[model samples]
Target: MNREELKALGLTDEQIDKVMAAHGKVVNSTKDKADKVEGLESQLEDYKTQLADRDTQLDDLSKQVKDNADLTAEIDRLKDENKTATADLQKKLETQAFDFALDKALTGAKVKNSKAIRGLLDMDTIKLDGETLKGLDDQLNGLKESDSYLFEQETEPTKPTIVNPGNPNGGTSTGDDDPFAAKLAKYN
Candidate 1:
């Protein structure tokens, strides 16, 4: 209230001044409290927004972690399969290479049995030179020299011929008039 109003209500000038001073203090204090409350509320809103953003980021990170784990497991399994396949392929190639080299070495060399010869030979001693066999030819030649009977030339047996009664001994006669003795003498 103003000084005139307080005076009309039968207050002295000094009392009116005192009441006005008290009222001004209360208004200022209330305004200060309200301003403080508004500031606090604004800060709370900002905190809530930040918390929501952080929660979203945490969820995204969790999802990414799970995906990474799954991918790692799949990669491990694929690596295992690749290792096994590589080993199998290498073994198959080695067998084919060995067979090819053996065939080349045994081409013209006579052997009683190719399988038996292969068994007698050692694969470790053989060396491959691109498309050719290095040590296998030498090994085969050594085998042929040591075992001549095993690598002998194949020959047909001769058949025995019947002797004629005209000749006492089996000998080549020029004519029937020539004596068998003369044919035998020429040979002797």
Candidate 2:
């Protein structure tokens, strides 16, 4: 929230400053997570490139093995296994990245319960374009227009803070204040 927005909300300059500081802190925290996610995505892409290179190398090796029947058989078997394994691994990684991004977007959109929101989404329609979700914002906007209660309203004075995974006061906990546990608690 900007200073003007806070001022319009009837807060004094000092109060606005405090709120802005808190908001900035929260935003920076989110940005850090986003950066980490981006790094992971980059790494995943690199793995895909490496896999392609390995496939090329395997093809080269296979050509060299053509003179030896046993070597050719082994190379063919290895090539098939590598293709299947790489395809499965790449699919799994892509799925994970998509899920991670979707959940992050859902959180940033201030959804009250992500599991509930996910049920309303068309998985087929949602596609991940790098860090952006191609169809999610449109769907979220539609949902906000129709099912407003599914999300948290921004008008509230005190925003609910998420505890991160590292800092004791900010991260994981088995207790009530733990963000992960609290999210799980909603379902329980």
Candidate 3:
């Protein structure tokens, strides 16, 4: 139905004009509200994108923190292992020193011949009978140097005397009559 038909039925010209103007104003207001709602929706989408980015960044930082903690724990474990290894090595060194001291004492008791002692003795007073003897002497010396307090307790106050085991002239051999002297003479 047309506004003219409604006016013919009951309304006047002024009333019809007023009603049309009011309807136009309501339509314009609705269009303005719709525009505002669209702008707000676009802003909400932007905020959602920002929130997603922040969440991803937080996750990455959490992973990095966990990794750092793991590395720190590993370092602590390695340090503890190193400390245990050092203690074990020290104990082994002390044990070897005591055994060497006992072996030297036994060898001195068994060998009565003086020439043999002279022949075995090196310039440093360490026995050099064979590769095995030299190795034993080196091990003993290393232990002594590493543990000075133990070395002092092990070494006796009296110096050991060298005796000759061999006698070329079939006479009683002494430290002075050592036959191996000639072999070491050139090196000295």
lDDT of 2 at 64: 82
Local distance difference test, each candidate: 0.66, 0.84, 0.53
For model 2, what is the C-alpha lDDT against the true structure? 0.84
User: RMSDs, each prediction?
Assistant: 55.4, 20.7, 53.0
Q: Estimate each model's TM-score.
A: 0.43, 0.53, 0.29
How far out, in Å, is residue 67 in model 3?
Answer: 3.3
Local lDDT at 17 for model 3: 74
Instruction: Give the per-residue lDDT digits (tens) of candidate 2, residues 1-188.
Output: 57887677667677788888878978896897778888887978887887888788888988787899888888888888888879888888988889888989998898988999999999999999998899999999999999999998887566434454666555445577558878888899
Decoy 3 TM-score against native: 0.29
lDDT string, candidate 3, 1-188, tens digits: 45987576566676677667867865785586567656656755665575566556555555566658876676556556655655675565444444344344424333333234334434354443422344445544554466444332433333334454785457665535466876676579
Worst 10 residues of 1 by lDDT: 155-164
Which of candidates 1 and 3 is the stronger one according to lDDT? Answer: 1
Q: Which regions in candidate 3 have their CA more than 4 angstroms from the true location?
A: 1-13, 68-188
Model 2: how far residue 170 lies from native, Å:
51
List runs of model 2 lying over 4 Å from the truth. 1-17, 104-108, 112-116, 119-149, 156-188
lDDT of 1 at 50: 56
